[model samples]
Target: MPNSSPPVTTEAAPSEQPVIRWTEAGEERSALWRSERGAPPPKRVVLADDTTTADTAYRQACEGTALLWRGDFHNARQLLQALARRADNVPARKRKKAAQVVPVADAFHQHRLAQSQRARMLGMLLIPFNADYSIPLRRAPDVKTACTEAWGPADAAAGASVASLRELLGITSAHEWRRKGVEIAALGEPPHNRIHPHYGVFSPVRGEYIQLVATAHLPKPPPGQTSLMAFDVGTGTGVLSAVLARRGVRQIVATDQDPRALACARENLAQLGVADQVQVVQADLFPEGQASLVVCNPPWLPARPSSPIERAVYDEGGRMLQGFLKGLTAHLAPKGEGWLILSNLAEHLGLRSRAELLEAFERNGLRVISRIDAKPQHPKASDASDPLADARSREVTSLWRLAAIQ
Candidate 1:
């Protein structure tokens, strides 16, 4: 249901790149298969062009046949839209009927299965790109910059390759986000407020959580300590670190294990003019020493992530959450507070329970001193048509204030 199969690609040898072979122009042609999400190369591929009907393409795609587009790029996009309409065209009454029969957890699983299947089918539509990341089809956009940002400098020696048009579009979208940036009111107004998210790093679009950190009470430094030191664990874009710095924390150490996240956090902190006040480090969870305040906003769901980006959303076994809680007490200074920013979405979805979370804090020698809650302001929270809309509507994000047990 979760697309659990490992990626399978045809590799000539361990040292060679995986290749996709297909028949075109009465000749056997092959090229490198590229998938940022580690999707396997299609087992069967057929060339499709302007003359290809959306219905035919949809049928072929459903049967696991990849369509290598040779026609106008815009047509391919339109065909993809058509495929989506057909894929999601199930009657509303039927959907409601299905939802009525299944439990919420079962519904969530079924929803994931549907999503996985849809992605596979849609990904069957491929676009060819030159080694420099240029699409050869007429009306294709200039995507060299976006591709370079996502895949790193293109290898001119690797020749042409094929990838999902959807993925390319996503890269393009992420590039725009990186360029335009997302504004954080918690950081202040206008020109100084934006946080430019890197291609793979998670964007802090949910401002409620950021606001929670921005307004939370800073713990008093122990007697005789003149300055406040804080640790921002798993800092994705350094947004929380910036907030801590702005709140007058003397020095803040922000740590993340991901290279992209580390780089992203450093760049954002500099851009926000707080680089001098924050130190971005690489670590699994906590850094070397204890801090007066320790903060973490781990992934909300305890489910398997399909890709690196999804890691910011799914925690698989609540690993990050537990890791932070278990290590919080050891990383907090005397009388210091550990602020855990988390959502109740997992509980609403039945993936976890509130009692389990509280028990985790107690088991880790931590006691909840207080909590600050914020209602989600994201659009999905109000989107009644979403499969999990019922759960989302009641979702509340909280910043749990914890201190080490005496």
Candidate 2:
């Protein structure tokens, strides 16, 4: 059966906090909630433990029942793994029809469905929480430090809570990611100097985009001006903005719609000592004015995201790309140029084409003046075993210098 509850997207503020009410030993007890992006509360929840067989747990989960685990920590983890294996055992109906070759797009869609199903099934192992983010299960390790690191110091009355153990693992992982950040060679600093990413903010591990920004020649200065101004659209971790500042752009306006990303960018800029050169703002796209150079690295894919975090990598209908193109002319000072950094992975996947992209520029009254290309060196590019290996292997990153057509 399909998952009864839909996963929550973090960006869309929940109208109300989720609460779980269940009858345990004939006594009703409840807890308020936070999420890790899985289905809404299951209609029914039953307490489970080491005694709960994997068969029973899997059956209950498939039937839309939440299993509030009261087992030993390690056992709970094992139950989750077993449940995942069960979930991946596909039924005959979902198997390929005889003599049928799945289309590339269809295969991709199926892959996403399997991933979603696996997540929902594994998320059935629920952990109870104190108001301060402690797991009350026996043998649970101290996650207070990690929880506080990700969600901030919890409220004394945040209330009784039940959240997925998988989510807790992610919280701890994010805490570690922030502590030992990903290094960006463009940001000249000690090897340890890094871009600490907060949960949900996209990390700039792909240095190709930053490399293009670092080397792309700046547009000629406007008459009577000794300095250049730039815009870093959809700035995540403000890494691109920092790169522009390092390139000696006198002023930059870096913008992002997510509060987490906005704050993340500000913190990164301050760390890079470019806080004074860049103004980080929370805007849907562009900031208040025109600039000599506008740089945008929109998500390359044209698809609906499954969750908020996916938004950084998937631009629905290519809205961000089109918007940047449409607004480029109006926001350009005389002789101004816009730099568009993009990847051709979507083309290889049959999602978008190069002709369509250039036509988008034509529709927006802009023309490409120059293009800088870089090949991706990320591990995924060469991982021949990835589901999307065909597309990844052929991907090419490009930095297109664009200008308003005369």
Candidate 3:
């Protein structure tokens, strides 16, 4: 069942009572309302009951009003469902009449805009949480661990209050994922070595990219040499690092800026028994020094992240990609290779171009040694209901092997 608890209001009393009113039957029920001293009374309020649709509650929330749900716990969930349907039902804007279809750039922008709007609308539904991480309203189960995992413990002085329903749902989902763990076979081993990703850490749901890393031909052994060190940059959950370690790399340096990702990678690597072979480090992109092989699986999309959590999926303004390209040469041992695992989904969406990537490589004095591509097998690739299915259906993930031009 959907969680449908309204956010708890924390209005404080002001110097005097402010107006408290509700409109019904073309009449207003007025009462004096006071908040804590110097604090303001709630500007608006709405009643929540089993009969109230999530849409109605959301509408009130959008208007800066709160819904005090008096409905059954389960009924609130149904209302949330109604609200979601309404939010998703908006017709997409008609394309401008032109012989040429909308450019991928414009389509990408519009897609992001629509996504932002949908998120905004859905976020209006609020969920209240107590200091003990309990849902105070009836039928509210304990969500303390979930909330703590996401928000880093509750603030008691701040008092029990409400938060966006969307955020609450996300936290709850993260909790479940953390507990159960996502099974990833990309490491290509027995059950004991599987990767378990944490919340906010990008899961390698798309197997194509991981396959690219796992199958790409490693650089030839040095003259009379049999071993080389490899680095996996931004190694979320250490999937790529484990893949490299399994592929016979003598040593692997895996680095990431996110603490959660670093921790997740460490745990997964340890589980895989490759911790001794792979050294996990906290670095923005590349760790100090060069390596015989440097690989990075950066966020494929080049756009601003709407929230901090989206960083795993969105690379704002292509900063990470650009940083990788610009810094690859400095981190590559002479004759060594840099394997960039990327998706062409951004190009399909019109967010970036093939030429731009090629140009970046050239400008960095890096030449494509070889390119290997694989088609995405995710269900979304075949999901016709997805607004961008047409583009997704044609998406390809690739491993771009690069060598310094020098």
Query: Which prediction has the highest lDDT against the true structure?
Result: 1
Cα RMSD, model 3: 6.9
Error of 1 at 206 (Å): 0.6
Error of 1 at 353 (Å): 0.7
Task: Give the alpha carbon lDDT tens digit for every residue of 177-274 in model 3.
Answer: 77776665766555654667776776777787888887888986445567787889989889988888887787889999988888889988888888
Ranking by TM-score: 1, 2, 3
TM-score between model 2 and native: 0.91
Residue 60 in model 1: lDDT = 84
Please provide TM-scores, in order, for all candidate models, with all chains considered together. 0.95, 0.91, 0.83
Local distance difference test values of all predictions, in order: 0.89, 0.82, 0.73
Tell me the deviation in Å of residue 113 in model 3: 1.2
lDDT of 3 at 192: 57
Predict model 2's lDDT versus the native. 0.82
Q: What residue pairs clash in candidate 1, if any at all?
A: none
Quality of model 1 by C-alpha lDDT:
0.89
**lDDT measured at residue 276 in model 1 versus the true structure, 0 to 100:** 94
38-86 in candidate 1: lDDT tens per residue? Answer: 7868987888888888888899899898888888999999999999998
